[model samples]
Target chain A: MTEIKFWRGFFSILLVISLLFFIFHVWAVILPFAFGIIIAYLVNPLVDNLAAMGLKRSRVVLILYLILLGAGIMLAMTLIPSLIKEANAAVKELPAYTTAIDDLITKANGEIQKFIKPIFKSKSDVIAIPFAAQKFIDSLIPQLPQKILGVAHAGLWIIIIPFVSFFALSHGKSWIDIIFDSTPSEYVENLLGFMAELNATLGGYVRGLIIESLCVGLLTIAGLWAMGIKGAVLLGVITGLVNFVPFMAPLLGGGLALLTAYFQFKSFSVLVGIALLFIGVRLFDDFVLIPFVVGSSVHLHPVIMVFAILAGVEVAGFIGLVFAIPVAVVIKVFLSVALRHRKERLMFRHEHVYS
Target chain B: MNLSFYRLIKKLFNDENHGEEMSFLRGVPIFFGLSSHQLGRIMQAIQKRKYYAGEILFQEGQIGKAVFIIKTGRVELVKNVPEGGEPRLLGNLGPGQIFGEMALLEHRPRTASARVVEDGEIFLLYTATLEALLKNHPAIGVKLMRNIAVMLSALLRRTNQELENQKKS
Candidate 1:
């Protein structure tokens, strides 16, 4: 009886998760909502920190939102004209990349055809990437209408997010109180302490990840541009964005770039430099970035982290991967604060023990 | 507005859902992606209570009627294990967690005893009340059940992990 109930419960959960994943990924209207969630996560720590300093969280959030608005406008004012000129120049250079693409594809098609198909099905799988690179260039310049639609879509969310975040952050204090108010009088302090720890761990980890990824992307873009790499802007964006996927970004990004560099320069040294560049970025991220950001967030065993990621992936797909660590941290925090045996923190100054 | 703000803001931030601001339970993994209306319903059905230190929440052999949400302070589970192993202090629970859930879910006699370790608060959701709430507001129930499943799955996973770690050691 128990076994049947258990399996039944498990499958139902799996089903709901899959449904939600489909909803988020497939629904265009849901994108704005997803953006809101991302913005909320990004700004929550800022709101919390501000609130700790005696300002009302909502007003602080409002102030920050205004600053973000100003900064975004300022960035566009400075960056847009230059970006447009370069983008136009890049468009003029598109046919050249297309010719390059066709040449590279033709050169590789023979060697690739020999072994790739039996192992991997499509010829397009290996070839389409470089072609897509050309297509991305073509589409960007030619698809003004699509770009306009995208801007409108993204802009709607951009406008809505601050208002939503403001409300959420400002009134967050009240929200927490309601949660406490719902509590049976006896376990309030215990629950509050547990919640505090959970908040810190989850919030800290997420904020750290955002900062690290942005830092990596910004630095890589600057570095690649300095190195005179073609399409440095695009490559940097791709690398930085993909940087979120721990232990996987370098191989994917580097391998692609290595092929590009190998063909472009047709020499060993450029390839070596490119390879070293990727290795350097990976080393920096793994050794310096992740250690600083993700290390102190949670103390889960590696297996647990892997399981949590898998579970999150199963539940929400790609978006879930981003949220998985924080969720896992929350669960861990729950165990320690809400479920662990009482141990006084040495930091508690003079109070011997609350109990 | 200022009067209301002063009265409310003067109080410690407790309920994240009512009065001052909506509870940020929306950020909680359990309540993710739920609409404000949906999240609000769950918050509304809930009720809070307080308990002093050393109170016995429930005991073995007693039929559990309510699930307790630890708002603050600690609740320890004193369990009787007699396989030549020492009796277990299952845990000391702190804020924002729900316990007595298993008992509430199954009409089982309390398998272990729960006692508050300090002056604490809990939100008691009687099964009968929650059922009615579930009937009237099904989304909240669905979300709540999902959240509980997550908690259970986590507990099960941790137990599995501990067993695996023990084996490895």
Candidate 2:
């Protein structure tokens, strides 16, 4: 029996490691399906609501698809053209922006050198920040075409995601039923409890994140357009996408907005205004959007959250970062449930002995 | 109507015996007085599973997490005797009967064990799912809780009456 237990433990560990390894290796291939699953999960509550009203699940899914198709077509006709035009304009002005960036870096480097001159014995000892910045910009310009081409390659995802999500939305319940049916009767209750807890934790968070990002994106676009900033649409979209990563929204979004404002308008006041706008958005997000939308769905400690994000980055780069919080939430819920089950079992044993 | 139109209409509205399921749920004691729509919502949270004869649904003294409603099954409630002989048979339950319902009120040890007497299907409503529903839809929750309270009160009164009779004898 001891040998059997030892082999079981060993195999479990081995299985987990193998699964992780497989995921790491094939993540790029799996990304589109992962996105489909997330979309299905996000849309499930609406489907459930309508289904509870006695609508056929398949018909409801078909109706939802029709609505989404119409919306997508509308967006394609209107938003896509404007976005493309803005992107083309930005690419054309890249050289001018590079020059402006170089000039700014040079000026900043001069001031830094002046400040550090007394500390350093020789001028050569001082770092050339402007040179490094220029080199980095030069390196990035050559990669632009390739990066754009890579994005174009991902057009296949447009077809695959909805196809996968449609089936998932319609059939997700049956899949869950199959799992429940396969589980031993003794553990079925525990499985259900675990699922309930997981849904309670992650469902609200995922849905809230999407809504929050959309609001932020729309707000950013409106604010930038009001200020007559160039590339407002593109920048807003970028800002919204970056908002998924904690603490990145303001840093990357604000920095890009400031640069574009300064280079285009060449005014300190515009840069300051852009900075103030981001701060306002961040405040609004923290106070209103998060509180009302996300509520307290995830209860991970801030420290643990940071560590999970870092580990995610180390494991799978950007995808890892995007999924880190949800993964951490799952782990936390699993541990809590498992520990509770163990505690209950021990307590039951104690009671039985006394009885 | 043309055959294609008839088929389309049928496809659109046919939610496979949903009426039958709702009617069955309406017969449940805890769900008494709930509207058809309310019962439908509750049915969305219920999970149906099949159990074979001789299978244990739950054990005595184990923590309860879900209430089981027999859809088409015979279940027996059994309790362990203090003297450690054969377990005492509490009662047999059939379709529409529910067990482990106290778990919904609180996470506590089940008072008796439930075992499947015949192979059939049962519906499981997890406490967490019910709590979520209660939080989200209070009207349904109010009716369900009130019915549960009434049932418990009747049980208490019956027990009290039995105790009085035994004392008199």
Candidate 3:
């Protein structure tokens, strides 16, 4: 028994480690599937509502798919030339950013040496830091090949996911029925309860999210436009997409935008305006929109939200960040159902008296 | 003679031919002790609504924004469940049964789907009204919870008895 217990414990840990590693390993390939699920979840309520109104779920899914595809095509048609132009422009200007960065680093190093060498009385120490940093960056660049491969895998996955989701949504009812019928009666009820709760949580989340993302995107565009930045739409899309990752997204997007603004405008005032815009966008999200929209429905604390994000990032890099909360919500749904049933059992009554 | 007098009042209140609706509050235990004036206040707040046969009374897992009381006709509780299998019937509910009481304290999602078996009239009580009622009559919340506890416990006991009988058979 002792030996079996040891082995069981060891295997459990191993199983967890393997599962985590596999999730990370296949994340690039799995990202599109996860994205597809999120998309289906976002679109499901609309589709279901429409379906309830005499339209077929399949037809609804088809219509939504078309809208998404048409929108993507339109975006590509509208933005590709400008995007290409920007790409070329960025490539052309890449050297300038690099040069500016290098100059900045060199100037900072010069100041450090001036201040530190005499105080430390060590001539070589001040020179050592830059050389080490530069060497580290050079070493890291070679590892980009795997990351590039991951991006390619992600692209392939994205292309196939929508078609898969359409099929999932259309045939979902029968598939759902089959799943429910296969379970034992009691378990079926539990599972049914779970699905119902899952639907509610995901529905609330997706509805809240789509509205929030659009708000963030539009606000970001307005802010950037007011700040006199070029490519406001593009920056807005980046902001919206990044906002999906919680707190880090807006900052990252804003910082990237700021870098471009600094380079393109070369105006300190423009830089300040850009910074203020990001802060304003974040504040809007934190205060007015979040309270009214997402509100207290999910009831996850900010600290728990942060921890979930970190864990998600650790296990699946970026995709985990997107999925962890809903996944937690599902577990919560299960626990809640189990507890409700348990509560009933605990409060067992021989007689049901009426008021 | 005294029993007959109590019966007369009960018949008068319970009779549909008297041209008055069964005030929904009387069916719910917590509201029994309320003065007629207080019950009248609750009745004024209610939205009397009707549903036809096959019409959804309420969907399972929907956010319970209102409390529903079934005054007449039967309701079948179903769950539109899709796991990965065929969906199963959760249970059935009937007249005088309260469907949305589980979510009285908060907007807990409806656990079971309900649809009218025949044309049915129900009194829809909003959560806001309940909140106000709780404020005005502080004991109502506790009484309401106790009523729910009793209902839930009764369901468990009946199920238990059924299982034991099945085993014996």
Candidate 4:
């Protein structure tokens, strides 16, 4: 019996290792599939409502697809061109930005040298820190193709996402039922309770965050444009997309905006204005948007949330960073449910023994 | 041209399999006073599951998140066992009858255990899904809440009469 148990544990570990290996290798495919799942999850409630109105699931899916297609076309026609134009402009302005940044660094170094020269007896004794800006550029130049390839891969998956999501939304009920059906009868009720809790919390949180990100992105674009900031559109998109990452995203966005504003106008007031805009946006997000839109779904500690995000970045780069918080919530909820079940079982056993 | 357009629209919205599910939902009492359209909406939130005889659906004191409706099954609603005694069978539920209903109304533990007496299918109306539906369609939420109130009142009246009879005896 001990040997049997040992083998069971060993095989379980083996199985887990193999699964992780599979996930690691197929992350490229997995990312698109994960996106599809997210889309399906977000759209499912709407689909269910439509289906409840006597519309066939297939027909409802088709209608959703058509609506999505129309929206995509509209975006392609209107937003895409402007976004592309801005992106190209940003790319063209990159060299000048880098040069300015280099010059700024050099000026700061000279000032530091002047300040420290008095402390040192000889000029050679003072450490002359040289900025390796060229090395940074050279490294980035080689990685440029890989980054473009990644973007192209993402673009391809964007086309496939709708199809995957359509099927997921249409058959979501049956799929959930199928999964629950396979569980042992004794644990089914407990599992269902867990799933319902997960659905309510995680699903609502994700949908809310996506909407929040879009709102932040749009607000950034409009604010920057009104201020006549260069690459406003591109900066806005970056800000909005990054806004999903919580504290890190806003800081990154604000820092980029400040740097750009400093480079372009080179005025302290403009930089301060840009900073104030982000501060206002953050205030609005915290007070109004998060309350109305996101609610208090993600009950994570700030320290834990930051740690998970850093770990995620280490593991899977950008995608990891994006999904870290939601994944942590899922794990936390699942463990809590399991612990509750174990406690209940132990209590039951104790009661039976007393009886 | 009109006929083609009508056909296209029909093909767009109609599902043949929805008929059985729709009819089943219409019969559930909590779902009473709801229109066919409303019933169809409730149907979306319901999940159907099959259980064999002697399988426990839920245990007494276990937290319930969904109300179960018997679609094609017999379920024994049992009270908790006394020390060194068998579980007291409260009643059996057949097709169209519902149990674990307070699960839909509130987040609370089950007062009685539900165990399958025969191999059959049951539909579950999860509270979260129902909450989502209510949020989206306030009218349906109002109707369902009213149904639950009425059902509870009737149950209380019956229990009161039973208690009064016992007192007289």
Which candidate achieves the best lDDT against the true structure? 2
Cα-lDDT of candidate 1: 0.65
Candidate 1 lDDT by residue in tens digits, B27-65: 445556666656555454444556778777776545555
DockQ of each: 0.03, 0.55, 0.03, 0.45
A314 Cα displacement, candidate 3 (Å): 3.7
Each prediction's RMSD to truth? 16.0, 2.7, 15.2, 3.4
Number of backbone collisions per candidate = 58, 0, 8, 2
Candidate 2 structure quality by residue, lDDT tens digits, A333-355: 87887788788877766453112
Best by TM-score: 2
| Model 4, span B2-102: residue lDDT tens | 99999999877877678877787788889988988888877766777899999988877666778899999799988866564787778989999988889
The reply for model 1, stretches above 4 Å from the true place, is A1-31, A79-91, A109-151, A183-197, A255-268, A297-355, B1-169
Per-model B-chain TM-score? 0.76, 0.91, 0.70, 0.90
What's the best-to-worst order under lDDT? 2, 4, 3, 1
Distance (Å) between predicted and true CA of A16, model 3?
10
Instruction: Please give, as one word, the docking class of candidate 1.
Output: incorrect
CAPRI quality level assigned to candidate 2 from its DockQ score: medium
List model 3 lDDT by residue over B70-162, tens digit each.
777777776544452544576566666676666566655566667777787666666655664565467656666676677778888999999
Return the clash pairs for model 2, or none. none
Lowest lDDT 10-residue stretch of candidate 2 chain A: A346-355
Task: Give lDDT tens digits, candidate 4, residues A1-355.
Answer: 9999999999999999999999989977887888887899898878877776777887788878899899989988977888899789877888887788787878887888788888874763356656655567867898999999998987899788887888888787779888988888767766776676667657777788888888988899899999999778778888887776777556988998998899888899999899999998898899988999988556778898899899889878977887788778777777776786577656554332111
- i-RMS for every candidate (Å) is 16.0, 2.4, 17.6, 4.0
Tens digit per residue, CA lDDT, model 2, B53-151: 998888887788999999997999988877888988888999999888898887767788888989999999988888878877999888988998998
Q: Give the poorly placed runs of model 4, Cα more than 4 Å off.
A: A1-17, A121-132, A340-355, B1-4, B17-20, B35-38, B79-87, B105-111, B131-145, B163-169
